[model samples]
Target: MYCVQCEQSNKGGCAVKVGSCGKTAPVADMQDVLLRIMQGVSAYASLAAQKGARDAEVDAFTPHAWFTTLTNVNFDADRFTALIAQALDMRAKAKACAVAAGADLSDLPEPATWNPGTTASELAAAAPFAAIQRFMDRDGPSIVGLRNLVLYGLKGTAAYAEHARVLGHEEAAVSAEFHRIAAFLATDPTDVSALLAQSLAIGALNLKVMELLDAANTTRFGHPEVTMVRMTPVQGKAILVSGHDMGDLEVILRQTAGLGINVYTHGELLPANAYPGLKRYSHLVGNYGGAWQDQQRDFDAFPGAIIMTSNCLINPEIKSYADRLFTTGPVGWGGIPHLTGHDFRPAIARALELEGFTQDAPEQRIPAGFARNTVMGVADTLLDLIGKGEVKNLFLIGGCDGARPGRNYFHDLALATPKDSLVLTLGCGKFRFNREDMGDIQGIPRVLDMGQCNDAFSAIQVAVAVAGALGCGVNDLPLHYAISWFEQKATAVLLTMLHLGIKKIHLGPTLPQFLTPEVLGVLVDEFDIRPTGDVADDLARMLKAA
Candidate 1:
């Protein structure tokens, strides 16, 4: 199996037995087959779309199915087997739609026509020849690397699009782009310029997805506002909701509203405390734990039920908390109870049966809810401070947090910023030093928590507003970025930054293993993307540049 779509790929690339994220060779192979089948479905779907015959179910399924192939989302081979069959059936329906519309289908690729059997074993056997890497033989490393960039970016975009879809938000153009890219990859073209254009196009598509999600979240929950969330546990039966799904979290909060169970946010859900509609619940206590990578230790020590709503679910730690663990939406495992149709009663019952916090822990608090609206609310204040030179440098430091070493660089860099500068953080990466006492510059807090990684939209809004107020391009503003990434969502966000002409981003922990030197050189030369260096050195360089 060969998978380098994530930062944690084993020994640079998972080219041998299994993936570093605990994905078995069989599961990885099955995932590859599923992706190939998805391309076939897309092949027909795109043709059907061209002929003005569109299927909403087929359009929605494209992102939902693609989302399951993302890193650490699904590990169950049986699940992939079922999805493969579904894709095959969908392909037939799409083909019928295209033929009825009088679209020609004679010149399709193997993925658009071949059926690799029904069983898991059959799919695994076909994986080697069917995988995207098969194009490396004809396309070479640089082109293959660029193709993978587009592929991973699409996976990230699909994940966000699925989240938006769950909330009754859908754009026909976004769905069309998914089918467009899927059909593009099916052909395995070797033109480097075309592939690069596709990469940036994915970035542009992702911006739309993020905007849709931002609207979905804000419209449903109201814009996030400043709120102090209790970091310590309170005495009660508890349920912790993790991952990036606010809709699932809201459903859980509703069903458990009058049941005397306390619903707590964990991981990316930490920002839920700041949303007006969600925080209005009296029993939705506070955030627990730090990041997804620390869940093994955190969940084991927790005294209540847990439900993972989205990505970053690992396999090795399930046995430690499997009896109390549940999954919903696209997140799945072989044994975990999968909640469907937003019925979370089983999870709530489990939480009721388990003992929660026996007594209130010592009180501690951290702030959240500084999304786009909140930041812009204080824009005049921010700009006035910048003009007065009270705030000289603005540092945006955050992304996905992983268990791998060297992440302490972000922790150290966040602490090393000048007191006059403000630190803007989002995603799980903020757990590194979010609790630190950075005080405030004038009346503005030094560290601003800008919702989840899903809230990168908010960060982008803040950047653009600040730059426009200063009468300069975003790249010319006195702002610096230190981005830490672990998965494809971060890949999509990085591409969005590049797409906006934001330059000189310091990205690290490690560069993506899928990026060959030639491709990395292009990013470095074109966008001035830098691999992070020593904390002091990078900090000094950023300050010097400012």
Candidate 2:
């Protein structure tokens, strides 16, 4: 097995017995096999869609299949086996539709026509044919790395598209583009320039997905308002909802209503408190945890049932709370109780039986809801401060956080920013220093917490708005990007930044292992991207440039 899809990959790639994310060789290899089947499924699906033979179920499953393969989402090898079979079935249905539509399939690649015997051992044997390391051995590092770059971006795009689809928002064009790219991968294109262009195209595709998610969230929940969320726990039977799916959380809130259970937000769901539709629930209490990386300790301490709505799941082998841990949506572990169709009665029953917080803790709260609309509502104030030179710099520092080393740099960097500058943060990375008091710039809070990682769209909108008001391009503004990447979503966001021609951005704590030096050089040459250095040095440098 070989996997370098996350920042915490073992050494350069997980080519041994287990991945750093706890994915075993069997599970990892099977995931590759599932993706291989999906490529064939997509090859036919894309052509079928072009011939007006689209299948809605196949279209939806395409994104769902890709999203399941993302880091920390699913680890059950049996789950991947089921998905592989499902992909083959979908492939047959799509191929028949294309054939009926008079589309040609003679020139299709192996992914579109290969027949692996239907058995676990047979699928395991086929895994080697799909292994990415084999691609690296066949085609050199540069070409393979660029293709993986595009593949990872597609994974991120699929995640966002799944979120949007659950909210009743989707576009056929988006799904068609995803299949087109997957079919392209089936051919094993090796042209570096063409591969690089496709990588950027994936960036543009992810931007559309992010936009769809933003619209879905805002439309369903109303624009996030500036509100203070309690950090202290309230005494009651409780269920903690982690991950980034508000649609799932809303369902839980409805199901558990009047059941004397307190629903707390964890990780990226911390921002849900500011949404009017969600916050209107009196039983919906406070945020209890920091980020996804800290979930083991957090879940162990919380005296309630836990529901993971999406990715960022880790193994529960060492935890006693695994019994009470529930999986929903695309998140799953080998033995955890997987909930479906928004029915969370089992989790609710467990929460009622368990002992929740015994007493009301000391009241503490933090501000959230500074999404694009909220920020733009106060744009005149921000613009006036910028014109007067009171706001010296705008530091956009946030992305996925991990337990890996060198992450302390983000915490230190946020604290080191000048008092005159505005620090904008989103994603789980803010959990590092978000609790610290950064005070305020005039009437504006010095630290602004935008929504989740998908809300990187909100950040981009804010930057472009600021730049337009200043009569300059986004790069011409005094905005310094110090992004921290942990998984493919971060990869997709980075590509979006490059696609926008945003330059001189800093990324860390370590670069992706998949990128060869030559490909990295190409990105650096074109975008002026740099690795994160000393916090004090980066602070001084960004402030000086401002």
Candidate 3:
């Protein structure tokens, strides 16, 4: 099995023997089969939609299928078996409908019917390991790379779409586009122009999905507010919830309330402190660690159960603590138990079983609780400061944080920002500058935390408001976007910026492996996108450009 959908691909290429993320050959093969089944399901769903069938049914299945195929979301063979079976069944049903309507179709075998029995040897023997091999043999590297890129991007979009679905905001068009791309991936390799159009369409549809999620989060949680959160460990039996899903965090917080189990935000969940609805939970403790990359070390020390809600899950090395790790909502791996059907009771019970610390450790505090609503509440004051020239410039510097050494660029750039400027950050990337004593300017915090990666929506909202108040387009505002992206959500956000014509944004530590030179050219020409260099030089260039 060959896998190259993430940063840690074996030797910076495909993971042929075992996944860099700790997936075995059989699991990787099953994942590939699951992906093929999903594509088949998408093809059938797209055809159904075109033929005037019910769109909601198609929408319900589209995003979760893509979400399940994301980098580290699902490794559980049982879960994957069920999902593949469901997709193949859907495909078969759609084919039957098409036939009744007098349409002839290729008779493809159903993917779900292939059963991988419980035993490792039996599962390996039963799974379709050869199918993916044949497909890869038939496809060129460029075609395979593009398909992987689009598939990964869809995974990211599906994650956000699923989050929004939990909050009751549905966009049928976004779902349709996902199905469209999935269907496209199944077809024979197309011309470059057609593929390019489909690639851009992924970007376009992603914007709608992000918007829907942004709306769902802000509307349900109340706009995030600028508030300080302690990093100190509180005394009690507690559970750590990581990844980007606030809905899951909220539910976990609610369920753990009377159970004597405290809940602490980890990774992307660090931003949950900004939301009024989530923050009001008395038992909701502060953030415990930095980014997703540090989890192996961080999780080792923490005695409580850890629940991963989304991407960037690196498999743990300690096999003894396997039962202590719980995952839900698009995050999974082989041998790890996942919370199914939105039921987190198992996670809470595990937290209780492990018990927590008997006493609180010395408390440490860091400012959190900055999101779009929080920023906008003080917008008038910010505008007034800008009008009087008290605030010189604004820097929107945040994105995914990784193990890369160059990520120090964010800290250096934040440090280099003039004292008169305000720095806005979100996601784990903020950990770089969040610890810095940036100080306040006229009662407004110099460094504003805008929640998780999806909360880049909050940053966009603040940018638009600030620009409107300053009587200029968003590009004309004294703001620059220097973002570090690790996954597909970042891809979707960058596309949204392009869709809105926001220009002169800087991205790093390196560009996506999936971006063709020609596609990169389109971004450079259309959005004035550039890669990050020396922080001092970049700052000078951005100021000069402004």
Model 2 gets an lDDT of: 0.89
Runs in model 2 lying further than 4 Å from the true structure: 11-15
**Whole-model lDDT, model 3:** 0.75
Q: Per-candidate TM vs. native?
A: 0.98, 0.98, 0.89
> Which digits, one per residue and each the tens of the lDDT, describe model 3 over residues 230-266?
7878888879888878888888887788888888888
Worst 10 residues of 3 by lDDT: 107-116
- Candidate with maximal lDDT: 2
Q: How badly does each model clash, as a count of residue pairs?
A: 0, 0, 7
Off by over 4 Å in 1: 316-319
lDDT values for all models? 0.88, 0.89, 0.75
Residue 162 of model 3: what lDDT? Answer: 84
RMSD of each: 1.3, 1.1, 3.5
- Evaluated at residue 136, the lDDT of candidate 1 is 81
lDDT of 1 by residue, 1-546 (tens): 888888788845655587778888788888888888888888888888887777888888888898998988998878888998998888888888888888899999778888799886688778887776787877788888888888888889899999999999998778777788878988876888888888888888899999999999889999999999998899999999988899999889889989999889888899989999999899989999988888888888789999999889877454578899999888888878999999998998899999999999999999888899999999999999999999999999999888788999999999999999999998899999999999998878999999778889999989999999999989888899999978899999998888898899999889998879998999999999999999889988888888
Error of 2 at 509 (Å): 0.2
Candidate 1, residue 9: Cα displacement in angstroms equals 1.4
